[model samples]
Target: MRQQLASTFESLKVRNYRLFASGQVVSLVGRWMQIIAIDWLVLEMSGDSGTALGFVMAIQFLPVLMLSLVGGKLADRYDKRRLLLVANIMWLILSTMLATMVVSGLATLWHIFVFAGLLGVVNALETPVRQSFVSEMVEPKLLPNALALSAATFNAARIIGPAVAGGLIALFGSGTVIAINAVAYLAPLVCLLMMASDQLHRAKTKPTDTRISEGLRYTARRPDLLLPLALMFVIGGLGFNFPITLALLAKTVFNTGPETFGILTTMLAAGALVGALASSKRRERPSSHVVMGAAAMFGILEIVVAFSPTFWAACLLLLPTGFFMIYVAQAANQRVQLGVAPQFRGRVMALYILVFLGSTPVFAPLIGWLGEVVGPRSGLWIGGVAGLLAAITAFAVRCRKRDVQISVNLRPRPQVRLIEPERPTPAEQPA
Candidate 1:
């Protein structure tokens, strides 16, 4: 048990990662609080219009879709720590501005949209650099654990942030929450400043002539890389719009306020926390089958949550929904990061971020519109269906590529299994 615990948190033994993780824990909690506040503020301002919320989300992620690749190129050529410091400073400034606007009662929906877009631009640059920076902070063997622990920190914040924000919003209003988040940015900035640069496993800087197209071409040739990227693109574009979906569901379906919404979000985060911790125990990169299987399970759970009869039931269901969601993500991320060449890590991860998050710009508004037109539960239904289809498609394509057969048996406790192609005897060889 002691050895297992040590292996799970092995990355934290690295001083740089320990510092980075410590600062990130504080900062991410604030960030998640800010997200909850922003979603709530949008709902209150827009008279609970899911479409408006979706539009804001779209604006926020548009820059990620457009500029993440460029950000990746910059990461490849520059110092990631310095880049992240700059990004966090910008975040502090922006969050402060938004807080002041809100507190002064001068904020409009357009003001929120503008700020969201600006933050999105910063995120485009920060995300890829941040994702690839894990490798620089720890040894190669510890990469998977580091990534998983990083996710655990995010989800832990997810669990804490919303619960705290919900209560804070109830008492002091969202402006205060926003202001607090602005202050939280200082933690990471200070952490970055204090990091010992000599300790980083920094990749040698690439030449200025390195092109974004090179990353694309490299990904095109590797099936191992392609499968996870493809899954992320499909599932990410269609299935992962929780901010818009959950807020709308709470307001329209349950007729609840920020507190209940926070509870719902927290439940999902709780499951995600469990998933991240579980993933941290894995010493090796996960297989393609594991990634797809988790996705399928997540989809099924989302569907179950959609059909939930009560608010508490939906909350209970979100736990497993969140688990599969993060499990698939972590598995796919480990696969891509482990498979890529070091020089291409930033660019390839940018593509991963592009597909996983950048696609939000295209899908967020659509899901929001669907919630308004179809039903409050429509987003979950659509997400679940998309996940199921994406997983099934990936499985079919993989089996065909390997010349393998697949079988399903239902009579004796349902099971689906892959059957490998048989190898020929030595006599059949061309000797």
Candidate 2:
């Protein structure tokens, strides 16, 4: 048990990762709080209009779709730590500006939309750099663990942030929550400043002329990488619009307020946190089968939650939904990061973030419109169907490419297995 525990959290033994994780714990909680506050504020301003809320969400991620590739290239070319420092500083400024506008009663829906766009621009640049920087903080052997723990940190914040934000919003206001997030940015900024540059595992080949197109070509050539990326794009674009979906569900479907919204979001995060920790115990890169299976389960759970008869049932269902959600994501992430060459990590991860997040702009508004038109549950089931289809499609393609055969048997309690293709003997070879 002790050995397992140690392995699960082995990355914390590194000083750089320890500091980074500590700062992230504080910073990510604040970010989640700000997310709750922003969603509530938008709902309040627009009178619970899902379309308006979706528009803001779309604007916030549009820059990621447009500019994340450039950000990835910049990460490959420059110092990642310094790039992160700059990004955090920009986040601080933007959070502060939004807080000031809200506190002074000058904030409007349009102002929030504009700020969301600006924040999106910063995120486009920051996300890939920060993701690639994890490789710098830990050894290659610890990369998978570090990635899982990073996700655990984010989901841990997800568990705490919304609950706290709900209470604060009920007591103080959205402005106060935003201001607190602004202050929270200082934790990461200070941590970055205090990091030991000498301890970093800097990449030996820092290619200054790495093109985004090269990363694309690299991914295209590798079916292993392509499979997960394709699955992520479909599931991520359609299945992961939780903010809008949950918010609309809370307000319109359940006739609840921010506190209920917080609870619902917290339930999802709690399950996600568990999933991340469970993944942290893994030493090897996840298999494609594992990724696909998780995606299928995630899709199935979302569909179940869509038809939940009561608010509490939905919240309860969200727990398993969140687990499969993070599990598939982490599995896909490990698959990509582990398979790619070191030189292309940044640009390829940028493509990962692009598919995972940048596609949000295209889908958020559509989900929101669905929420407005078809009913809130439509958003959930639609995403669920997309995820299920994506998983099935990717799995079939992988099996066909690898000449693998799958068989299922129901006589012995329903078993399924894959059979590897037999290789031809040298005597029978044409050559």
Candidate 3:
């Protein structure tokens, strides 16, 4: 346990990555604060249209579906550090504009929605770049540790961001809190500029004859890679990780104050941070079966979370729910990265990002509307159903594959023990 603890901070031994880690910890907290602020702001502005609130969430992620391929290509083609620097700068500008609107007392729901979409665009481009950047920041052996550390940093922010946002909103209002979040963007930007440039890995993008189809073709041919990718989209992307549900529950079913809402998110984050920390210490990438099993378990927990009668119960349940959700997500991620060939990694991963992040647009509104019409519990039930279904399907796919492999193993071979008539004739001839 002590060794794992020591090794988990392995990435931070790299001076540059350590610096980057610190900035993101602060920045992610701000991002979480922005999330709570926006969700609550839109819910307040629109009354209680669960579907509308989900739309607000969906629109933010729409860019992932639309632009993630380009983002991946760009990440592969450009200097990741520079791209992040630019993206952070853009976020700062957008956030400051949001702040300006707040200060002028002219902010509206559209402003939040529009900025949310803008942030999504930045994220679609930025995330792939971010994922790929860790390898550059550390030695190959420490890469997993770096990845673990990064997840830990994000989860830590998750733990802190909501509680702070809730208190800030309760005390001051959402506007100044948003402005503070905007200022927070600068931390990452400054960190990016200061990082050691020579240490980063620069991926060379081969100018492709088939640029558009490249990412798709890579996945179509490899089942080991494709199956998990598909499962992740179904389970992780479309079914699990229901922020829309979180928004709806906080606003409608609970009819609670911001502090209570913050507590809910904080609990989820607490679980997530723990999950991240635990997974980070693992010496090897977990198997697909583990990932799928965890994915299914997450759904079951969501169903449990759905029936909770009180805030603390729901909050307590969120811990395990979050732990499983990220495990499903990160497990799939580690498998895909380790499974694929490096040459096709850029676009193949582009598709992975497309499925992983892109599915938000298609389902966010659906889940939100489910919560709206059926009540908050509906999302937990429907989302749980969707998650369990995906897991069962993945299990079936695994079973069918095993059955095929066994059939092949048991298949008839060239005769070894018997050729009775011919052999008798040969023996007679020899006699």
lDDT of 3 by residue, 280-318 (tens): 776565677887898889889988898888877898999
The ten-residue window of minimal lDDT in model 1 covers 422-431
Q: After superposition, how far is residue 203 of candidate 1 from its true place, in Å?
A: 2.8
The residue pairs found clashing in candidate 3 are: none
For model 2, how does the per-residue alpha-carbon lDDT over 126-181 read when each residue is reduced to its tens digit? 99999999999999999999999999999999999999999999999999999999
Clashes of 3: 0
Candidate number that wins on lDDT, 2 or 3: 2
lDDT assessment of candidate 2? 0.92
- Candidate 1 vs candidate 3: the TM-score winner is 1
In order, what is each prediction's RMSD in angstroms? 3.7, 3.4, 8.5
Query: Which residue runs of candidate 1 sit more than 4 Å off their true CA positions?
Result: 204-209, 407-419, 422-431
- C-alpha lDDT values of all predictions: 0.91, 0.92, 0.77
Candidate 2, which ten residues in sequence have the lowest lDDT sum?
422-431
What number of clashing residue pairs does each candidate have, in the order they appear? 0, 0, 0
Off by over 4 Å in 2: 405-420, 424-431
Give the TM-score (vs. native) of candidate 2: 0.95
> How many pairs in model 1 have backbone atoms within 3 A of each other, for residues 3 or more apart or on separate chains, i.e. clashes?
0
